[model samples]
Target: MKKFAMVSLAGVVTLGMVAGPATSLASTHEDPSTTDYSDVDTGHEEFNEGFNIYLALTNGDVILRQGDQRSEYVSDVQRLLDTRGFSTNVDGIFGPNTADSVRSYQDTYGLTVDGVVGPNTYQSLSDRHPYPNELFRYGDRGEYVMEIQRFLTEERGMEMAVDGIYGIETERNIRVYQEYSGLQVDGVVGPKTWDSIFTYVR
Candidate 1:
């Protein structure tokens, strides 16, 4: 009887050891390094599903479709972030990974990460782009603004200061150029006005 009891005790201990590992595995999940976000939520339950917040800001409309264009914009932003050394899922869904990358960018650029790209965020992204970002700006204070000032003063012969100051002088020169180009003389360089300026300057 003692021998039988000893064998039963050994069998119970073996079962417990096997069950312990199984229990731990049941409670644990795969590490994110091996996990994929494409298999996760698509960020559709909340606001406009595929409408990228940044493009909406640029176009003066809120995107509500999680379609190809939205995905493209998100992909572009993610690519920018990746170039900036922030690794993200890049799944075209503006979820936690994208939000975190935006926060990282915001923190670096002194922006507020309420997760919405406003004027300041847009300016920051556009001003520091890798290539010449002349087409996507509207007179914010930055290197491109300085470049615009340089173009106006040197190429356009406006006798204006190239100090990156969007003061009355700059506005006047912009309006003058707009009138010359038969634009609306709004003193603001929209896409069409900007294209005209470059066409004339070049």
Candidate 2:
């Protein structure tokens, strides 16, 4: 529960909001104004060229800029907030709450305190563990978990019915797995469980 001070960008005075303690911040994106694509006259294709798709963050953590307004990126930011126990609306508005959460994230990760997602901030996000989507593999047994089941059946020789239902048998199997791996034998497919499951898959 560290406190963060929001400073205006009068000068480039970023205090490494995420990774504090004087860790140097890196700027991976070009100096172009990273803002909403709607304001520019450039066509979609041109904007796509400079859209920085490779800079997308999969985790609920990111370096958000002060004035960005992309729907997809806003979704990413919202996801980050949700992952970190914040229940803010994911409406891509870049409002005050998002700003405060970004400040908290910056302080947590020790990034520049600009509250603007930049390259150095993006790098910090990439290194985070327990990303939001990782939980999808457990519940619902959707496409992702189904894929995991397939890998388990083919590789681990565990005779699991691929019915996409995480019931008692699945939990039992998971407990057996955790016990075998010397993990907390709670029968849950947590991050450590997933990592151990990978060993069996290959």
Candidate 3:
């Protein structure tokens, strides 16, 4: 287990608290996942924008694979793979380690063992692999917890290392997210809290 020095934030928090007074819920509207991908062959402006939108959509094209192509999408897939327990360096490089992890994921999820993230593989991964609504608290350590840390870092703009250890820093970030999402300001991440985060992602 990696040790992270817990940093204190300016809030009165008691560890493991949940179910407080309800706060104003934020609008949980997710934008439609629509994108025109007819121009991927032309490599024009349409191709560029469509390809990017395709990548951003969870059910996007399989442009990321075991090669030297580097992008934030590769890094995002790496992070999701790390969260699913097929550990690989999250350096945004789709190297052998990432390929091996992808293969492992394919095997575990009953997908084709091609070591490539094509449409089928990507869809299965996007749908099946991610955990849904797991309660996270301090002293817990694993990819599940690491996911929350990653969300705080990537989505919510929190400054912290993604070490998979739920310490004070992680809890502090969760509290911040809770406050921002208009949910109860408890550090614990239950289904409601998870839903709030998911709404933001969509």
Candidate 4:
């Protein structure tokens, strides 16, 4: 295993291990200091490899192609494709179906109809359905709320309906997740909460 260090704004450093060298570490976030890198490993080589891909995805530096290994980042790209009306399975593996979907998306968007998801294709999809940046609290409603609800349910195993409405139940679940993540136990979803959530999704 090879050790890597990620430092936070508070001057706290956490270490993780990967079975091989990381592919990329580029980022587009305005303030990298807000991101938390605590769950980057599980002491297993296979799991660490997936986590390395996840980190690159969150950093906006991943270049996925056909025949790539399984990783959550591939699943994320599949989800984005499906959201744009190109149906594809959300399986973690980047197989032929995913490549076909990427080609279709690229063709429709007037991009080079290559199956690979390099920087330009990824940026176009991101621009179309950009991640939510506004602060969220009780009574908010829309796709952003649904995004957080889905993240909480899928990633954190929180039992809640992804109805795109921030109600008491949603706030309660957010508070629970905040407390568990060692963040401020406030119900509002702000920069810190978004950073933590995107650590898994981006």
lDDT per residue for candidate 1 within 1-202, as digits (tens), equals 0010011253342111221221222123333223333333222222122123444544545422223246655664565466457676677766676777777888887888665555565545534223232332223344445555665554344546775545545565666566555787666655666655433411
The best candidate by TM-score is: 4
Model 1: which ten-residue window has the lowest total lDDT? 1-10
Deviating ranges (above 4 Å) for candidate 4 = 1-54, 58-62, 126-136, 139-144, 151-159, 175-186, 189-202
Write down the lDDT of every candidate, Cα atoms only: 0.48, 0.48, 0.57, 0.63
Residues 1-202, model 3: lDDT tens digits: 1222232236532222133312222233221122232322221333234335334544544466788565566766676677667898989789999999999999998988978777666555544223343466655665556666765565344566797766656665666666555778767878777755533422
Q: List model 2 lDDT by residue over 30-146, tens digit each.
A: 212222223322133422322243244423244456566776676555655555565567888777777777777778777777767665654453232321224422233333344
Q: lDDT: which candidate is best?
A: 4
Give the TM-scores of the predictions, in the order they appear.
Answer: 0.33, 0.36, 0.46, 0.50
* Candidate 3 Cα outliers beyond 4 Å, as residue runs: 1-57, 123-150, 154-156, 160-192, 196-201
Per-residue alpha-carbon lDDT of candidate 4 for residues 82-124, written as tens digits (9 for 90 to 100): 8668888888789999999999999998999989888678756
How many Å off is the CA of 44 in candidate 2?
22
Residue pairs in clash, model 3: none
36: Cα error in model 2, Å: 42
Instruction: Give the least accurate 10-residue stretch of model 3, judged by summed lDDT.
Output: 24-33
- Decide which is better by lDDT, 3 or 4: 4
Of models 1 and 3, which has the larger lDDT?
Answer: 3
True-structure RMSD, every candidate:
28.8, 21.6, 12.8, 16.1
